[model samples]
Target: MNRALLLHGRQYKPFKGFMEKTKQVWLVVFLFAFSGRVAAQADTMARQSAFRVFLDNDFINLRGHGSDQAYTNGIRLDYFNVLSGRRGLFSWMPRAGENSVNTTGVSAMQVMYSPEDLKKRQPDSSDFPYSGGLTASYSLHSSNPAKKFSLRSEITGGVMGPPALGEEMQRMVHRIMGFIEPKGWDYQLKTDLLINVDFTAEKMLHEFGRGAELVGGANASLGSMNNAASVYAIFRAGHINPYFNGFLAQTNAYRGSKKLFYNIIVSPRAELQIYNALVDGGLFRRWSGRDVSKANRPTLTASELNLGIDYGFALSW
Candidate 1:
């Protein structure tokens, strides 16, 4: 009996050692990945294109998913006199053409500009267009807690052209508060909330352009960090353009008036650290594409895929 007990104890010692080493290895790997992501973010912020130009291209083929094969390209340009510090930001989110399967088109570019950099360059508050810009953002995380949690949010907004122009739009919009146009860009006040805890992880809530729309969804991240991905289900409801159709003199006779659609998106996002720069690639499938005029039209099964990439730059005082 004594000899048998000794053999069992000896065998258990190796198992315990193996478990401890395994835990240490995983911890090291997690720290390495986290540090790498932070370093990449910093690098992105440090390196600014002399002209500050950005282009995002999406070559999406949506056949088995829901729609036809489609491709999208977006371009953004910023001209800055790094010497004199004069800068201008311009962008376009135009689509190649109308897709028959999904009838999807890219939204207009969100435009914004500031004479001085809010992050670093502080100008006289009295200066025209001193601060602000257009808004665009994204976030990502996991549903499982045993892994790690990564969440991010980005927003860009500011007045374009001279302060006088912003004043002009304000004046005109108020003056013709009763007149309506077919369609036009509307100011947006979007807020996003994300929560990941317990088994019920990942929730997204968003409000777009005031009462124009309300959206909510849940997501699940699958796979490991090296091969991470997520799937989400989203629901959007509200007027297509409340300001344009109701206040901006736009005709409300078509299906474009008040519409609601249920969209399911199988989003695949990947992160990579290259040369200390963190690059994120996203692909989205927006299903149930249809223009609702009377609310009785059958919802289309077509899908629209969007591909996007964003790079964050780290700045330090």
Candidate 2:
């Protein structure tokens, strides 16, 4: 009976130790899970509180050297926020990676086009047509830092021609800058409805330390305003941020380390333009007693294939 009791005590001691170790393992797991959840919540809150504004104008183009022709002035205003709930138009979109960030944004934009000589009341027919567009767009952007990829989708609606107020905006700016008044307004593209959908995808090709990186991307647009597809590569150097964070790295709200940002970028692109309403005029015919082509205005014969290079520098805090 003594031997049996001793054996039972030994067995009980081993079982008790095993049980205690199992409990400790579960406790560690629970702590880790709790900490992960807290971190995720913090990230979500930071994204929700972030906002940004953007303005673009060809008048500020560094390569133009004060000349305004072809694709001229443009202005854009954007507001963005992280999507808190997956119950919207963009909810069905697939994320790029396991831990991808999603953002929704709205924007208002105005674009202007003109010939080389703005002083001529009746510009050369072969020159770029006088046209303008004003649009409002809703967009969805998704990015994955680990995979170094991003996706963007957007839908836009608005109007073209005089209703866009391009001529008036240009005149106001020119008057403010003490430049010569533009001469051709009546010959601008006629009023027309504008609607388009666009999608873009970008991936980091390679990274050369923290100072430089190469990114490649493609964009597609379809609608009454424009139908085109293009591919481009971007080379950025200087104090650059992660490009996967967002367009122009504007959506890096969770980054708390950087107080200032600056970069020099060079992008080369090739586009196959199926159609461009701004250059080709409206798709539908107008019988308003105006002498015009099938598109209801004077249009230029634009190249179906276009190649261009862009250089710019950005500084922001």
lDDT tens digits, residue span 57-156, model 1: 2111111111101111223443211111212231121111222010111112222212212222332222212111222321111121122121211223
Candidate 2 Cα RMSD after full superposition onto the native fold (Å): 23.0
Clashes of 1: 21
Model 2 lDDT tens row, 132-240: 9999998888888888999888999999989999899888877876666779877888889899999999999999987899999999999988888889898988665
Task: List TM-score per model, in order.
Answer: 0.17, 0.70
Shift of residue 221 alpha carbon in model 2, Å: 1.1
The model with the greatest lDDT is 2
Q: Where does candidate 1 stray beyond 4 Å?
A: 1-145, 161-265, 268-317
Clashing pairs in 2: none
Error of 1 at 82 (Å): 25
Looking at model 2, residue 169 earns an lDDT score of 89
TM-score for predicted model 2 compared with the true structure: 0.70
Worst 10 residues of 1 by lDDT: 1-10
Global CA lDDT of candidate 1, please? 0.20
